[model samples]
Target: MSAAVSTILPIEADQSKPAADPRDLLLHSIYEPDRDIQGLTARELEIIFQAYKKKDLANVPVRKAPSYSEAEQSALELWRQQVNHHMTMRISRYSMGCVSRQHKTSVSPAPRPINRTEHQVFQIPELLDLILSFAGPQVQIRAQQVSTNWRFSAISVISNPKNMETFRSLAPLPPVEYGQLLDDTTRSLPEPDSQQIEQFGLHVDHMVSWWRKLYRRRYVYFPAKLAQRDDLPNGIAQSLNELDVGQRHGDYHGSIHTVSRTTDLYWLDLSQFQINPYFDLLFSEKGRMLHRLGRWEIGLRSNATSETLVLDDSSSEKLLVQAVGSMHITNPPCRSLGIYCYDNCVFPMHGTHILLRRIRNSNGIRVAELLDALQSCAPQLLTKWVKCAEHLRRNVTETGHWVDSVWLIPGTPRFRIHLDNCDMSDEVSYATAVWTPEMARDAETLIGASLGYQAHITRTAYMSAEPPRATKEGEWLPEELFEPMKTECGRSNINWDA
Candidate 1:
């Protein structure tokens, strides 16, 4: 007989004695707990257990009764389920083994190799680099893990500086709310206060809030005027026009403009200009228009460097987003600033947008406050803003959704995107003009619009030619937009104007 048949074949019971009680049989097996009964092996004990399972001890009534509690019954049922699961697995494995053995014996001796050439084509340096450059950072890192060749190929391709440009070129164009003005055929614009730029520019806090807002957005003259100042010396005012400042090429006329917060940008001026400097529109190949607001600045560089500092425009924005995002998720103290700084890949320049030192010292600030301020002043940037927030929250904090304080400077420019904590006594006082010549020029235009939007609502109301006038005093203002915002600001003892 086979070993399996010999082990499982039943022994005929003698017809003289009564059948053994199932309870006594179970008691005999478990009474000692540790000492093996009759020196039975694991397989022998399993056979006896299987016999009890087949008889269904759960339903069988014992003459010598010991009833089980509900808890005990539930536990017993769960244990039975587990045993059943194991049995099913064992049967499946045995069946699979038999089928595999049979298959091996009957199959052909020679098997055709899979066509790896199709998969191998992706490893081609040029094609792989191009494809990988289009993927987000997360996907690129994962692709590197597939094989040694892939890691080498991905590392080399992603490391190239040229891929940055390719990434930008290939990315979907940003949504432009105000840039549409640049395209419309109407010579006369919808009323200044009625415009999207004016509505988004209503915040009273930062100089960026009111400073860049246009007095007039007659698209015809604005672009031309901005272009003229490209040669102007120290003409930061040209930024007001949202003109492309960096290097330009035939294939690409200029960089894209965006209002979203998550983008990789060269410059960002917070003042009233609707197409805020970095957020300005770009007229690219064949009049292609797109926003630059929410894109991340993926300026790739090799990791094998020491004492490295890179002059990147968006690094400050990236790190600030990271820092604020980190604080939101981790709820850590100021020391956590070091971790954020270290993760930035490069040391950001001071006064570029936000300084690491200033953030480290800012115990009074909260990431929510930063986000709230952005939403109030520039709601369009919120999605990318939150993306940056979540990225830092998950990666640095190693958690999701937390809150904490951070350092911030008090008051300057319209937008509070950056804060300065210069020591008042130690810092040298200079007789610097409050507004630069360009700023002063932009201010005149902004003041005119502000007065019209605020105090002159009555005057413009009766005119049928214009859209509906701003209904109340400071009616178009951000403070008036939502009641909760005003209440929160009030609780914080912060003056929106101040």
Candidate 2:
């Protein structure tokens, strides 16, 4: 090797530029086809190739070139800046990618679907609707946790106006959810019709649950039409049509007056009207508008007076008798008649007498002579009448011992007599009075025929006495009135015991 090197001549450089191979230049220039190299001219391509070749392979020099024209130079400068910016961004992204990959390999995989069955079965919109309609608020809230899609659907369905209306009408409801539905729907609808509002009044007879909720939550307010009026709210009357007035709290004393003024409801239930003062108002000229009157029940407390005296000179009993008598004389007559007196100490015989008198006194009344004849004979039956009257006066303690008797006349159901609260003294005697159905029927026929009206009398007697004797020893004796006679040593005849 040393001998060959000693004879070596000086090395000559290759002066010819390698023949310009278009393909090679193209390939070299196309380092980044995604960049601006694709549209390069021949001159630009040559410059790029030269720059690529001359520049150190390890560190390619990036230099700013001269502009071709003013516009071109500005454009080229902007392009250079953009390209530089992009290249910097790319390098950063590439480094991040490598780091991310390294980190990802060390991490565990995310969880797969846990409830495959539920995931498959629960479709977003359908599930939301079902949950809203059938499921409770608590369940709907739980469903919302599954994903954003579920939550969105749930909110949309619940908030939709049509959906809200439908939900409001549905039953087995959750009050809170139903309330929200109603509020949202009403708000979404166009302004409520003023005419309709006026005609319908303020309060609507909605579902009972809704009414209760509204009442409890203080959501009920007087309607505008009602509020503007000087009188009580019209809605009160409207609501009264559906509501059981008896079930409501308060005196119910002034209600008759309000009812008489505001409404034309024919059938008035007076079962709950306890205040005796209201009776006059009910049967008065102003109150007689009622075409169909419900049974009137009066509960007589221990302290209650024998007679409910009205402020007017005309007694309530007298007025009621007059009203009943007048009604009987009417051509068509009242379709029904019911008088319920519960736990009342006043005798029905007295009521009947007053009714007969009113009928007899009335101008063109047909029952005068019959009622007079009955009255004339009433005294002859005084013993039985007094006994019955006394029996009626007795207070019944037990509910089971109530005596009920119904008498059928020529027409209509028999009049029913319910004798409640018959005390120990009157039980046997009262039972003896109307013991048989035939007796009851006869009594009804006599009373109806006497009154000149097709009437039935039903009488029920309630007693508080101990059960009847099963054995002789258990027989209840009236110790208060009768005691075993004791022989006196000196007297020949038994002396009356005090």
Candidate 3:
């Protein structure tokens, strides 16, 4: 063991021998030029190759070289530069993409503002006028609430004088310019043409407010104000084609005389006003000024059972006759006349027919007096006329048993007879007069024929009766007088005087 120890210690290998260059080893590990390295880098490939080669090479460690071969060093330098360049490019591209996305997200189009000028170009007044023309009454009022512009437009359109005229022209006659007048009063401003405000329609509250204002100004009559305010838009006098003065009760009366005098009204519906004493004022000397009148409707408060006598001495009929007759004599010749005896349920036989005949024959004087005198001259004619009378009476009945009958007779002088209370009783009998006593004899013959028709009707009624009559047909007095008159009995060619 001593001899071995002395000699074997000298067998130490050369530890100072030069080590293989690490760069050369690294190059050798990745030296395969034909090898395909896709996602893996050169360093990763080298690591993998060295890991596998390590088993075959034993535990020998590679040496660190001071420098590398030209080809190996170049390849290494190129690889490092390529990696750095790719990273830099990728960072630049990512930053550019992020900026582009942010720019797209942040950008937005500007919102447009409402153009007042464009709106004004359509002309607010014209727009409002169009709206009123196309829209109904409710829409006109509702348009005011749409916006401040709409409100202003509506007011301006209604208040403007020219626009008001257009509105009036568009209205059906008797033209109503109520909306224009209302706009003027609501703003507390004098209307542009007050004379044009002939007919007005106001809400209940608004009418009260207007009355109060007018009363404060000591306006005794609406007509005078109408004439004075000619410059006012839609004045009462100028626009006065038809006047409707509404009142809640029959006791109400208006100073319509002055208004009628100043206005050219064709129809006057004073249905809200009372008849009795107020009617006296209406048909007074001053009130008779309504010469243009074509139709008149006035309300009465009298009961059905009440006897409303319109005697020739002093009655609305006489006043109306005088008023209408005077107008007829003046030669303009009024064609149509309508009298609505509202609430006056009792129908006066003599007065109503006389009035109707007078109004009908006013233009032709030849028929006027003849018609008037016929009232007393023919008692049989009166009985025959009872049908018309009964018809007129039934019209205003509360029970609605009889309805008004209107007939339009077509001829050169066309006439319309409106029976307020029409009766359809088959039991009513009538008599008619003929030219001479001989013609009267012929009428009796016609009556005899008419009686024959009645016989059949009576026989039918007797058969249907619950308890049959004991009397035989021959035993009975024929019941001819009780039968309805022929239809011809209702027709007459005789012209009656007014």
lDDT value, residue 213 of candidate 3: 42
Query: Model 2 over residues 1-498: C-alpha lDDT tens digits?
Result: 122222222223322333445433332432332334434445665686555543312122122221145554444344434433433332232233444566557664795764534655466577657765566434444444566566555554444444323222221222120001122212211344566555545334442234454211111222222221223445544453333332222221224322232422121122211212222233233322222112221111111111221112233323323322222221111112222211112233312221211112112222122223333333223223233333322311111011111000101001111111111011111123334777655554443333222111111100111111222111111232121232121111211110
Best by lDDT: 2
Error of 2 at 92 (Å): 99
Clashes of 2: 21
lDDT of 3 by residue, 141-192 (tens): 3445455566555444444444323122222112111111212212222343
Q: Where is model 2 more than 4 Å wrong at Cα?
A: 1-308, 312-444, 451-498
Backbone clashes counted, model 3: 36
Better of 1 and 2 by TM-score: 1
Candidate 3 whole-model C-alpha lDDT, 0 to 1: 0.27
Candidate 3: Cα lDDT at 131: 65
| Model 3 residue 183 CA deviation in Å | 29
TM-score of 3: 0.17
**Candidate 1 residue lDDT tens string, 178-281:** 11222222121123333433333332123333323422111111222122122222323333333221111112232433221122122111111222111111
